[model samples]
Target: MEQHYITVPISRDNPQDVFTVNTKYRVIRRVGSGAYGTVCSAFDQQHQRFCAIKKMHRVFEKELVTKRCIREMKLLQLFSNHPRIIQLFDMDIVYGLDEVYLIFGCMDASLHDVIHSQQPLDTVHAQWFIYQTLSGLKYIHSANVVHRDLKPANILVNKDCDIRICDFGMARAFSQTNSMPYLTEYVTTRWYRAPEIMINSHNYSKAIDIWSAGCVFGEILGRKVLFQGRDHVDQLYKILGVLGLPNDISFWDPSEAVSAHIKNLCTTDGLPPPTEPVDFNAFFPSATPEAIELLKRLLHLDPAKRITAEEALKHPFVQPFSDSVEESLVPPYVDPQQYYIFEDVHNNSALKSMAIQEIEFFKHRMSQQELSESLLTNNTDGTITTAKRSHTAAVATTMRHFDSSSSWQL
Candidate 1:
C-alpha cells in the first residue's frame, strides 16, 4: 500500500482506527451490514453532502465476484452523470491494496423492506414506485446496462421517495450485441426472473428486464411478491398460470427450453398470447382500468410483444398518473429533525398513549381545513394533500419505529 495516497487534516480523536483515509468522507455511522461488506452513512467531504459508502470485500486478485463488482462499477462510472440510475460518486481505493470503496446516494428504505412490512404501501405509493422503476430502467437500457439482479431489495426509496437502483452485484452491460448469454445466468432472485431465463435461453435481450419489471409491478399491486416460487419450475408455473404460455413455436424452441410441452400446450402453429386477460382487478382493486390494462400489456408472455420501458412511460396509464409520481418521487419534505407521530417534547412517548391534546398542535386548524378541502375537491384532481402526505408518511414511519423499537423506554 502506498504510504501517502492522500489525506485531509482533521483532529485525531481516535488513533486506533483501522481505516485511516482521513478524507472529506466522514463515516457518519453504519446504516447497513451485509455479507459483502458494511454500508455506512457518510458525509462526502468533497461534495459536502450525505452519501452511502459501500465497501465491498476485495477477496482475491481475480475473483469472479470482485470482477462482477468491477463490471457494475464500470457501468456506474459510465452512467454516473445520469439522474435515474443511482449516482456513483468518488471512488476510494485502499492505499496499497486492490480494495475499493464506493460513495453513492444514501436512501431511507429499500422497496423489499417495505413490501415485507405489515403496513403495505397504498395505491399512491405503488404507482410512484412503478413509475420510477420504469424511468430508471429506461435510463439503464439507454446506456445498454441491463440490471440482471432487479428486485425489491435492490431498489431504494430515499427520504423524499426518490427511487434509486442499487446493489449492482449481478448487473451486466448489454450493447448492440447481446452481452447476457441465455444459459449463462439463472442468477436473479427467482421470484422476479424472466420466463426465457427460467428455460435457460442463452441469447436473451433487454426484454429480461421487462419481465422482471412485470414482477415488480405485480409486487407493488399485491403488496407482496406476486409469484413467490420456492424454485425455478414453480416460478415458471406461477407465471404461466397467470399469463398462460406462449404458443409461437418459432420463438420458443423446445430444443432451447426444458419443457417443449409448455410451448405446445399454450401455442398453436403460430405464437399465441395468454388465453385470458390477467385478473388485474383482483390484484389491484383500486387501480385505474388503464393501469390494469397497462400491467397486462407489460406482463405479456412473448417478450417481443412486451411493452418497452419508454413505451410504458408513454402509455395512457403513466401519463395520466404522472402528477402523482412527480409528487411522490420528489425528495420527501420530511424535516431532517422532524418527529414522526411523537414530537420533540414527547421523544420517548408511545404514539397511542399520547392524548389528543398533545403539546405541539398545528396552528390554523389545518386538519379541519384539510378535511373540508378534501370534500370539496373532485377525485380527478387526485393529489394527496400536503397534510395527508405528511400524515401518511409519518404514520408509516412511526409504525416502523414502533414495530422495531417497541421495547424502548424513557
Candidate 2:
C-alpha cells in the first residue's frame, strides 16, 4: 500500500499559517458553515479528487450536540455505500485534540440551493429527484434508520441530477415493528415536519420522513415550499388547510394530543368541531394526477396512512425510474444505542472525556495497517488488499466478520 500525505508550504517564521492534513487532503477554501461546524472544499491527493471537510465546532460544549455528531458519523458510515446517501471519505481526529473534522465527497449543490435559485424543474426532473429520495429512504428504512430531518437543505445533488441525502445528525434506528419508542421531543424542521410531530404525538414512525420527502417533492414541483408556516402551530394549520381535517383521530392519538391543538385554534369554545376537508386537486391544480396522488399519500395527516418509501417508489410517477433505484450495499446492523456518546445535555468534564473516547474509537476503526512482505512473498495464492473508503465500511465489515451481535466492540 502507498502512504499518502498532503504537504503545506510555509515560511520558517510562519509555519502555523499554512493549512495541511496528514498528507492525504489539502484544504482549498471555506465553503459553508452549519450547526456542527465549518465546511471546506479540499483536494484529495490520494484519490486525485475534490472533497468536503467539516471541522466540527464546540463538539463537547453540549452533550446533545456531541451525541448528535457522533450519531451522524456512525449513521453516515453505516449507509456509506448507498447511492443516494452522502459518502464519508475520512474522519480526522487527532489525539488530545478537542475538535474533529469529517471529510466527505464534494457535491455540486444542494436541493435547497436549487429550490431557492428559482430554477424551474420540468416534470421529468421533479419525478427523477423524488424517485431518488424514495429509493434512498427505502434503504435507510430497511436499516431502521429514520432521517428525522429530510428537507431540501439536507439533500445534495450533482450535475447529473443525482441526489444524496445528508445531515444524519438527527437520524435514529428504531424497531421496525409497531413497538417504536416514544420520541415526543421536536426533531425535524418546522415546515417539513410531519403532522404527527407537529402535534407532539409520541407514536412517530418512519412515515414522518415520508412526509418531509413529500414536502421536498412538492417544493421541486411548485418551485417554492408547499406549506410555508411561521411557527409549529401555523405549520400544522397550513397542513390541515391543504389536506383538510381527518375524520378519525384514533390513529393519531385517542387522548386528544393532535385534536387538542385543532380545538384550541379552530373553535371559539375549546371543543372539537367537524371541519370540511379540502380537495387535493384544488391545491395541486398544476400537478399531474399521478403526482397529486403521490403527494397526497405522502402528506397524509395520519402517519399510519402515509405512504411508505417502498410504496411511494411503486407509485406511477416514480415507478418509471425503478431501473435507477438500485439496491444499496447496506452493512450489517450495529445498534447505535451501544455507542451512546453522551449522557445528557451538559458541559461536564466527564462528558468531554467520553466524547473524546468516542472519536478515538472512530479513528482506530478507520486507520489501516501496513502488511509485511515476508508474510506474503512466498504465497502462491493470488490475493489483493484494498483500502477501505471510510470508517463505517471498515467497522461494518469488521463487525459482520467477527460478530453480528448487538454489542459491538473494536
Candidate 3:
C-alpha cells in the first residue's frame, strides 16, 4: 500500500525513535516511549491542534500485545465523552503493516514530569490533582472496570492544573457478581501497587486504584516517591515498614496461599518486626491536617478500609473543588460487554481484523458526529433548506446505528 506519510527520524541522537504518520500530522518531536509503544507530538494541520501520536511496535508479535492494543482502543472509544479521560481523536492502520497508530489530544506534561521538575506545588495543586484522579476513577469503577495501573506517569497534566488519565492497556472490566474473577498479578509499577496485589491476594477490587492515588498524593506533597522500593520484596517491606504489618491478615481477607506466602516472607526474608508507622503530621509538616487525614485513609493497608473514590471526593481536603454535578457517571445505556469484544479471541489474525474494524467504527462515528453537529449549527443559523432537512433525517438514521448491537464482529 502507498503510505500517506513519510517515515521521519525523531531525533539525530535517537535514530530508533522514528515515526510514520499521516501527512496531515506534522511530526514535531517524540514525547514518551515504553515497552508497548512510542508516542510523538505532532501538529495536525487539518484540526489546527497538537496531538500525541502513538505507534504500537510489532503489534502482532504476541497475542497478548495484540489484545492489549485492541482493548485500549475500545476502552478509549467507550469513554470518549468523558472529560477526565484522555480522548482518542483518530487512528490508522495499513493492511500489510505490523504497526497501529493512535492519535490523542496533546497535553502539556505528565504528572511524573511535574513531580520531578523543580516547579513548586502547593496544597491547592495537590488537592485539585487528586480530586481529578478520583473523579475519573469513580466513573471507571461505576462501569465495573478496574484501571489496575495508576501512577504518576500515566496521568497527563497541564499548566492550568487540569489532568486526564491515560493508558488503559492494563484495564479490565469485572462481572457484576459480588466476587471478582482471578486476574493477572503483574500490574501497576511496584512502588504504587496495592498491598493486596503484592501479597498475591485472591480477589482485588478498585481499591487498588485508591492506594495508588494515595501514593501519588504523598509524592506530590513530599516532592518524591513515598515508598521508593528497589525490588518486589523490598517494595512489600517498605510498605509494611511505613504502614506496619496488618494486626491480622483476615482484616483484608487474604487467601490461605497468600497468607502463607506473607508469613514465609516475614520469617525467612529477614524482614524487621512490625513497628509503629511514621507520623503523617511530622512526615508532611507543611501539609494541612485535612490533607494528611485524607492521605492516611487512602493508604490504608486493608482494601476494605481504604477510602472509596466517591468518599475521597467529599473529603475535607478536596471538598472545595468537588462538584456533584460535574462528577459524571458512564451513561446507563452503554453495555460493558462492548469493551470486552476481543477478550475471548486468542487468534492473532482475528485480533488484527477486529482492531481494523475498531478503527473503521471510530472513523465512521466521528464523521457521523461531525455531520450531526454541522446540521445542528446550520439549523440554529436559519440556513437549513428542504434538502438539508432530508440530509438531517439521513444523519439521524446513521446515528441510530451506533447502539449496543452495532458492535463490530468477525
Candidate 4:
C-alpha cells in the first residue's frame, strides 16, 4: 500500500512532548493534553484549513485505554454525518510506537473557555448554545449512545456561535435488551453527574446526559459552575443544596442499599440536608423565567422525572430558535450492539489488531471522500454535472476552509 502520511519533525518546548505526525499537517501549537492523548492545532495543507490533531501515545500500555481509543474512533465514524457532532476527518497509527492519531474538525474554543473569558453572553447566546447541545444529544440518544461525559470542556464553539460536541472517549453504546449491563459510576465529571449516578445506580438511562446538559446550561447562565464539589460526598451535597432533598425518597427509586447510604450521609455527620430548594429567580436573577423553568426540568434530582433532550428542545426557552422541521428529522442510527464486539477481546495483541483494522477502514473512507471532492473541483461543465454534484455533496463537506483574511486567533 502507498503511504498516505509521513512523519514530520517540529520544534517543541518540552522534549518529552515531541511527536511525529503526517506531513499533510503542519503543527501550529499544542492546545491541550490529558492522561490518554495530546491535542494540537494544525494546518491541513491538503484540505487548506485548520484541524485538531489528537495523538494518543502508548495506547497499548493498558487494555482499558486501548479499548477507549478504538471506541472513540468507531463512534466518531458512526456520527460523521451529524453537523453538530464533531466530525472525524482522518486517522493513522505509528508503525512501531503503538501510538494513534485522530484528526477532527477544528473549532475556536471550548464552552469552558468562553464561560471563563471576558466575553459576555446574552440570553440569545445561552438559548442557541443549549439548543445546539440538546440537538446533538437528541441525535446521539436516538442511536442509543450515551455521551457519559458532557461537561462544558467537551463542547467546542466558534465565533459564529456554532456548537460541536466532542470528546466521546468515555461514551458507551447501550444494548437494545431490556436488561442493561452494569455501568461504572465514574463516567461523568462529579459536578455534572446525575444524582442517580452519584448514588451508584446500577442501571442508569440516557437521562444522565440530560442532567449534564442541565449543568452546562446553568453554568452558561450563571457564568460559573452550578455545582462545585470538593469530593463525591461534597458533590452530592452541592446538588442537594440547590435542588433540596426529594419530598419522597421512593420517587427516585434508589436501591435499598443506596437508600440507606443516602440516609447515612444526611444523618451521620453534623451536616443537615437542605430543607428547601434554592429560589431559581434569586440564584440566577439575570435568567428569564423561561430559562429558569428549562433549567429546573433539566436539573431534576430524579432521572425519571428529568426532561429528555427531545422534549427539552421543545421547551419555551429555546423554542424560538428550534426548527420544528429539523427537530422532527432523524439521523442514521447505528445499532449499539455493533460495539460489543470489542468487549470479548482481552489481550493487548487482540486489541491492537482491532485498532489497525479500524484505522484502515477510516483511511479508505477518507480517500473516497477526497476523490469525490477532487472530481467536483476538477469538473469543467457546471450545468452538466448537476447530478454528480448532488451525489458527492454529502461526502464533499469538509472542514470550513479558511482564507488569508480569516482570523485564527480565539
**Clashes (N, CA, C under 3 Å) per candidate:** 10, 3, 0, 0
User: How does model 4 score by TM-score?
Assistant: 0.88
The lDDT of model 1 is: 0.60
Of the candidates numbered 1 and 2, which has the greater TM-score value? Answer: 2
- Which numbered prediction scores highest in TM-score against the true structure? 4
Put down candidate 3 lDDT per residue, 113-163, tens digits, no spaces: 887776667777787788889999998888888888899999997655678
1-410 in candidate 4: lDDT tens per residue?
A: 56555554433555556667877788888788888888889999978999999999999888888888988998888775676789788898988898899998988888888887767677877887898899889988888888999999999988667778998888877766534552542589888888887665664789999999999999999999999988888888788888888656665554676666665565346776785899999999899999999999999887778999999998988876666433543455547667757866889999999999999988987888878876775446654353211212432242232232333334
Q: Per-model C-alpha lDDT, please?
A: 0.60, 0.71, 0.80, 0.80
Candidate 1 C-alpha RMSD relative to the actual structure = 17.1
lDDT tens readout by residue for model 1, 1-410: 22233332222564432333436677766566665665777786655788887766542233344444444555665554444568776555563444456778777677776666664455557656787788777766765557788888788865455568777666665435665332243467889888777665564677888878888888777777887776776677677767765445345445645446564433234543465546778768977787788788777767778888878887776563443332222123422112112222222223212321221122124345557876876456766545322234533453322133222110
Alpha-carbon deviation at 373 in model 2, angstroms: 16
Indicate the TM-score of model 1.
0.67
Model 3 earns a TM-score of 0.87
Q: Write the per-residue lDDT of candidate 2 for residues 298-367, one digit (tens) a residue.
A: 8877787789998888899876567542545345655544434342335657766665666566666655
* Candidate 3 lDDT for residue 370: 75
**Residue 314's lDDT in candidate 4:** 88
Rank candidates by TM-score, best first. 4, 3, 2, 1
lDDT: which is higher, 1 or 3?
A: 3
